[model samples]
Target chain A: MLNTHGLDVSAAIKTLVLILDLVGTFVFALSGALAGAKHRLDFFGIMVLSFAAGNFGGITRDLLIGAVPPAAITDWRYLAVSILAGVLTFFWHPAIERLRSAVLVFDAAGLALFAVAGTQKALAFGLNPAMAALLGMLTGIGGGMMRDVLLTEIPAVLRAEIYALAALAGATVVVIGQLLLLPSAIMAIIGAVLCFAIRMLAIRRSWNLPAPPD
Target chain B: MLNTHGLDVSAAIKTLVLILDLVGTFVFALSGALAGAKHRLDFFGIMVLSFAAGNFGGITRDLLIGAVPPAAITDWRYLAVSILAGVLTFFWHPAIERLRSAVLVFDAAGLALFAVAGTQKALAFGLNPAMAALLGMLTGIGGGMMRDVLLTEIPAVLRAEIYALAALAGATVVVIGQLLLLPSAIMAIIGAVLCFAIRMLAIRRSWNLPAPPD
Candidate 1:
């Protein structure tokens, strides 16, 4: 019953989204691998950390939203991507560290993509708008949080710049777009751009959430 | 085609399992809250840690096995039990800390219970035996792992006494019992007792996994 033109358009959009997801996974994996290198973890440890950092956020979100057997576990491509990132970082951390700003930008991009994707997934699963938005933020920050925890550090999401808040902004935008019945491709782009812009600005301006009184 | 006596027996077993599960949740919550208190976290942080410690293991297990809308979220009693334990620990940490041996015993009990329960749940959901057993161990140790991470400490499971191994033993027993078509109640009890005994022995004798050479 579907028109060929409509099917082609949807397929192209899906392909675009999938590429974005893989890019997000790769950047996150690189970050995890870098953290492992900084800590002098063994090779196996680096790979494990890379996979955890790249996939844990989506895994957690999938678990919470009842998307069981998470994509991270079931999909071989994700595993390959994370491992490749780890191997690359392990071999070239010195060079990568010099590109810290670039890493941050990629991380921000990943956060944007994850926030929109997570929100859309939650809505698909029939969650309320508020909870969906929260899950989106969680999906954006959860992997980094887990990575820091494994390194025995307080999560950056809890202590650093407006990371979680930016994800929240993006997710909220997605939810509003849902309410307005906007095309998902357009909404995702808008939400991702908003999140990426806010995160970059936070980094540039050194914006931080208020800390608890010591 | 339902038999009255069979239904009664099943219902009674279910009740027993539920009671054991709640008890396990409470002890885990107590340990988490105690850790939070040690770190000088505020009341809200303590509550969050308690909830994470009490429920994350089961949540993880449920997610892996495709149990949607995990019981920890949908069931009110689990929330109440974790909250109560947190409140008690926050107000009485000094007294609780004085009873370190008692706390360890309770932790072991919870570990045993969760191991058996998690394995059974996985089996019920039709996971392969080896996978179910692994999930059971994860159910036993996952919460504490998350708790330690949140507190910026290495998980005891990765560095301490025979924690995860004991859970695996218990879960293996459940799997073997299932293969033999043993009664659920008896299998659960046997598995729990075995896990608890092994854990207690390991603590008493200072058993540890082999560490990497420095």
Candidate 2:
């Protein structure tokens, strides 16, 4: 059995969470850069969109939980990751566009990671379970929503996707695990896996929430 | 001369700020609802847009300043004001639309109020003068940006007009007043008036920022 209660384990979990967060930021930044390229925005505009898509979610989550300055603003790593993604996409977008499926996979992974991490952070901040779950979903979807918004598109989550539902399900799992006193690191993994699976399956099956009739 | 340091005076200022905030909320909500109606969205959609536009700026400002739960989320007044505006617009959109000029005037008022109020709040929270001014501009523009985003339109502040610049000028006035040890209420009034004047003049003169060549 793993010593989940050990100080070392907690520190390791924290480091792991940070790594996953950076990964998510990178992929979302890629999406933002791609969107900016599609719109033929200038290099500076692409960089702005990349950073907005990479960090808006975490920034919003931190602000909502009263974490002053937000990690995206305070941590240099977030900025570096976003800039790296933006530069790559700007210079090599044709190659990136050819890997659309791969990008979708990375986006799904990012969504799952953000949802679980956001839930854990909210819980740590003493938010109630319900609110924590909601915030988690918000954290997962916020970047994409902001990206779409900046590009003048209706947010997919509010339109035709099963995106937010997957995040909410993952967040709910984390919240339930917390209630059951499960090891948080393990629960985070399970929740993220569940979210990633659901999102991937939805994509494969073309699953969509019902929309108002045209 | 008013005793600016007196507890009673401070309380009065607080009340006055609240009133102005509510007024801003109401006018922004009206704009959102009107936008929804123009887009032919249903009543529910209009209400959602209204509430989002009315509260998003204040909520964002509070969150950035580490105020938990946000005044918009915690206070019933904000909700009531948004709902009132939404209901009014939903039922009487034609009559309201006929007053297009009046709506523009109200929007200017809302922008001015939000800019000064956001700057004051950020300063109170110990943010630097530069950041406070930026946040003030953000607060003034955020709601309309969100409304436009939801409707899949480019944000007006980003594309054209002197909208955000006007807000920044207003916020700068408040920040300078604070630095000079001036009374906050007087500064807020001056800032609001200056912002309102600038926005109205821009509308009258059809002023626009330079755009990229087509």
Predicted structure 1: lDDT: 0.86
The fnat of each candidate, in order, is 0.27, 0.25
RMSD of 1: 6.7
**Candidate 1 chain A weakest ten by summed lDDT:** A1-10
DockQ (CA atoms), all models: 0.17, 0.16
Candidate 1: regions farther than 4 A off: A1-56, A59-106, A122-135, A142-155, A158-162, A165-214, B1-23, B33-52, B59-109, B125-138, B146-182, B186-214
Give the chain A TM-score for each candidate: 0.94, 0.93
Q: Which ranges of candidate 2 are over 4 A from the true structure?
A: A1-8, A179-182, B1-51, B61-66, B73-145, B152-214
Please, what are the lDDT tens digits per residue for candidate 2 over residues B1-214?
Answer: 3485655766687788788789899999999888877876655557657887888887887777877867675566887899799888888888888998998898899999999989988998999999999889888988888888798887778988888889999999999999999987788899999999999999999899888889
Two-chain DockQ for model 1: 0.17
Pairs in clash, predicted candidate 1: none
Per-residue lDDT value at A69 in model 1: 82
DockQ of 2: 0.16
